[model samples]
Target chain A: MIPGTPNTVALGIGAALGLTLAVAILVLIRRDHLYIRQALWWVAVAAVALAVGVFPAGMDYVGRALGILYPPMLAAVIAIVAMLIKILLQDVAITRQERQIRRLAQELAMRAESPSSKDIS
Target chain B: MQDTLIVIPAKNEAATISGVIAEVRAATSLPLLLVDDGSADDTAKIARAAGAIVLTPPLHLGAWGAIQTGLRYALERDYRRVVTLDADGQHEARWIPDLLAVLDGDAADLAIGAFPERGSAARQVAWALFRRITGLGFEDLTSGFRAYNAKAIALLAGEEATLLDYQDVGVLLLARSAKLRIVEVPVKMRLRTTGPSRIFSSWWVVTKYMLETVLLCFAHWNRTGRQRT
Candidate 1:
């Protein structure tokens, strides 16, 4: 247990929630609903959650060692940073998709403009 | 004159498309292409009826995307020059020749027809801020009525332009980075007849636009190696 660890009830709750989320993600992957590349990151996120849930005391210890006054707040800080990084990754993907969409739109517009292609359509 | 193409990106412009088409046709014998931009209204039908070749994207790509579509078409068709104007009847079509003159004069690779006395106070302030930040001065940096040569067209229609968020300042910054000459010619413009200015409608919009544009400018600047002053 951590030096000033919260009750075991909270850790148990966190473990349940984390496992549930992790299973949900795995189910999505199994059904082929999510792309492997994207799912991999989410799976890692779930792993992080599970790790924290299983070892909540470690978080408190790490937080104190890192000079954080309130160790519990560390989870929130890590969650926020993780969220920000995920957003940045999504933005990069969006930029790629935007470029492709524009190119496709332009190509389709061009095909319609051509007289021979117009006849085919 | 024949080598030039006028591209107007229109969406839901049923009310004013016909008038603008007729005016541009009457003003010059130049071929006109109205990018329909996936308007649910009769934009494509009206433009076709008015005698402008209508090109519609598969989906609604905003004004800038539509403009880029037109630019790509011009590049493919081997046009020497391109003049782009608004379909809202806000930008006058008669000044088309002046923009062309700048292109022909070798004065600049791109000619932007700016209106010093036009636009609202909020828009003016936003433009002023843009000018100060980018160190690019023009009375109407956001003017849609502009002329571009083939070289400028290729640069903007290429992959780099995909990163651009908006056309006006984005296009200018791209041109500037390419070391292309940019000159702004004073052109007459009337206030928009219909709808609101999306970027300058409110303080929040203007702030957001500025932030996005500035971030994009720095992004492009660093990518292009601060190619020019």
Candidate 2:
């Protein structure tokens, strides 16, 4: 016995789309074109999208709780929020590294300008 | 190379830096190490004239970054103790010895000059919120007046500290996480010789600072596995 789905065709399409996205991400990572650190987040997002597509009932339950008539719209909303958070975290990380690199450069310059450098000994 | 070194981190404090340097000189005859954090003014020239060895970073890296630079310099020179204060003349140099006394007492690896009545209802409330969240018992969370031993200097000068935006809360959390003792001594801080406090300059800045600090606290808490969740 199996549970019923309102639209099996749409669910199948969503699952296929998510699987394709995950595969593409993996291929990019394997080819060394993409950093694993960043690609992992996309992979997780793809996995979640696939699960929601396969077992749409979970999202349907959530959409109904949130009073959204359409479940696919809910998936889209979740995907947007996830992407925004990923972008924000990356921005913070990059900003921090920028400061670090600048400081390192300055420290090196200061060391160079000092005539009586300690490293010479 | 010295037993005790006073490291001051300055940025665009040309107005009152010479006075601050003279104050430090009056208090102790120890070596003065001034880290100029890319000030556009004549801060480097003034500091040099005041007899402080000035090390100017090629670019602006903010207070914490400058302090880290000074700490690394101290570590390289093998200073046993280091005292750091603001260059805006807000932090009194006379309190330096008191802070060092705490380090000498073997009670703390780091000592902070804390003012319990640094007064501002909003500021107190913010400190209260952080106290409740981080469970850190320091009265002054934003004080730049602090003293550090070799261990604290080594830890702060490393890669782990480079990512921090603010020195106060982040440094406290890092020191506590490393099981290093942090002590506080009662000290009076004067009004800023320059303009208003940068942290409280605008509502938007305050909101952004709060958001970043809360995120940092959560990240550290998770890494330390201190939370039950």
Candidate 3:
């Protein structure tokens, strides 16, 4: 309802740009890390939404760029992305734990077979 | 009296080995063989010092493996019977007389020492589950304290008993499958002073034991159609 303000637009654009750059850098550094890559993608989308929510200039740009100005919808998309990322992380963790258990079982069998191993109390 | 060989599976039970050995010696002049299941302590030394013949396995084969090893040794030596007693000081050595008496009377091929009167409620529950699954009506199927005659020794000396992870229930089930007569004799169990029980140590042990017992029951049930009366 207020007049288009340069300061408000600049502040919102600055925050969005900073967050997007940070997420990009994190993704680049941790591309091999599954959980980090997933988290970075969610953060990037959330950063873009936050930018569009505050920056009046971004609203006009989004409408021209994507023909849309629905900032609230971005929040919902970000939440869904975050949930998917969390579930993927949990799956990775469970897989890692199962591998660890297999390794331990193998080690125990080897120890049991080795005659030179120290006796148990 | 027929010569009976007693097999005691000891693991780091040096503190009570001599006493148990002496009591078994005093109760009966049965030849005692102590299978030291790779105890890190002086269990072998003390058992040897107690004048009992000792066999040291290469690794810790656990209670079941140790007893199997001892049974094999007794079978090889041509012992008429083999009695297994705990070296953890929990079982009364004097009750060896009652177990031997039952065996000598030809009342049963296998006489198990039951401790239902002394065990806690949790142990009782475990016992009940084992009985239900294995269809073994014995008061205590998991009782390690037992006496096996020549028929039992020969039957158990086969590949079946050797492959078992736990001997007490597995041996009982195998004996029952072979139609070997099994009798339960009342024996007093004293409190163990050495360490905590392997059963109630934690949930992990309890769950593992339950799973193993259930598997054993399935195995026996599948092999033998007749349930113990």
Candidate 4:
């Protein structure tokens, strides 16, 4: 219901791009390449892309509401910011996993070095 | 079993590991455990031959990680105290008693074996800068030679200390935050006979260390006061 003159060509390209992303994400999730916890974010991103593609004028409304001079730049800015945040979250997850792996490695080494463990071998 | 366990964290120190182990054996009969930090050389084999139980991590855990592994081992064994020695042969075993004595006297929960004479000009500047930022009064802040009582060991072995890459400021800051009694025991250290300094191996590493340490100092300054206790 957003009001704007949406060009047919632009609408077709946007819809195709959104549909491709959505299908790709679903395929990845189905293949078990992406965990549910991580896939949730990608699902939301794909949903957003689909929504924007169906309603390109919505971006204009939001951008104008936010007082942006050029509405199209809003999408670019949001995508960049979202990507940065996603990358940062990945790093946080990596740090936690790294810490866990280190502790596990320590435990393994200690257990292997124990006299009883040596006796078993 | 002796209450105090000597833990040495060595990385590719095959050339010096045997000598260091021998020196420690000569100084004290306390049980020794060497955390072989994924050394490609025969550090583990040599250390075993030298009468030290060695823990070889599946992968490299850096210096602090290796030390923490030993601390965790000591914690699990209910050891009353732990003395950490660097495997570079710099940390002399003769000072082991002095550090343990400080802990035994209940003078401090953590005793740092300090040797200010070891700092070169560049090291002195770095030390001064770190001192100014962190407000730590110890002359030798980066000395790996240290004694930790049970309380300190428990604290450092916990999850809160796993992310620390260096044993210098990050560790001291954690100890400071926990209000552990810390004292410096003057001791002489041997000059490095092997590779270059780990922390100051290159200019790029030095810059990274400085920035990261300064950030750590500022991050904890609010929670932990500038008290020189």
Model 2 is docked with a DockQ of 0.16
> Model 4, range A1-121, lDDT digits (tens) per residue?
4456787888989988898899999999999999999999999999999989988999989999999999989999999999999999999999999999999999998888945224321
Clashing pairs in 3: none
- lDDT by residue (tens digit), candidate 4, B28-99: 998889999978899888888777888888978999999999999999989999999999899999999999
| Candidate 4: regions farther than 4 A off | A1-4, A114-121, B227-229
| Model 1 alpha-carbon miss at residue B100, Å | 2.1
Candidate 3 lDDT over residue span B161-228, tens digit each: 65576766778878888989999998889877778776678989889988887887886786655433
Q: Is the docking of candidate 3 incorrect, acceptable, medium or high quality?
A: incorrect
Candidate 4 residue B220 Cα shift, in angstroms, is 1.8
The candidate that wins on lDDT is: 4
Better of 1 and 3 by DockQ: 1
lDDT of each: 0.84, 0.83, 0.74, 0.91
lDDT of 2 by residue, A1-121 (tens): 2554657787788789878888888899999988888888878977986787678889888888999978669978887888799889989999887866866765784585443323322
* Predicted model with the maximum DockQ: 4
DockQ of candidate 3?
0.02
Which residue pairs show collisions in model 4?
none
**Whole-model lDDT, model 2:** 0.83
Task: Provide the TM-score of chain B versus the true chain B for each model in turn.
Answer: 0.93, 0.95, 0.94, 0.97
Residue-level lDDT tens digits of model 2 in B1-229: 3588888888888999999999998998888888888888998789877777778777777788888888888888789899999899989999999999999988899999998686588889888887767878889998889999988988987888877766788889898888889988999999776787768879999999888888888778755435542
Per-model TM against the reference = 0.81, 0.72, 0.64, 0.94
- Which CAPRI tier for candidate 1? acceptable
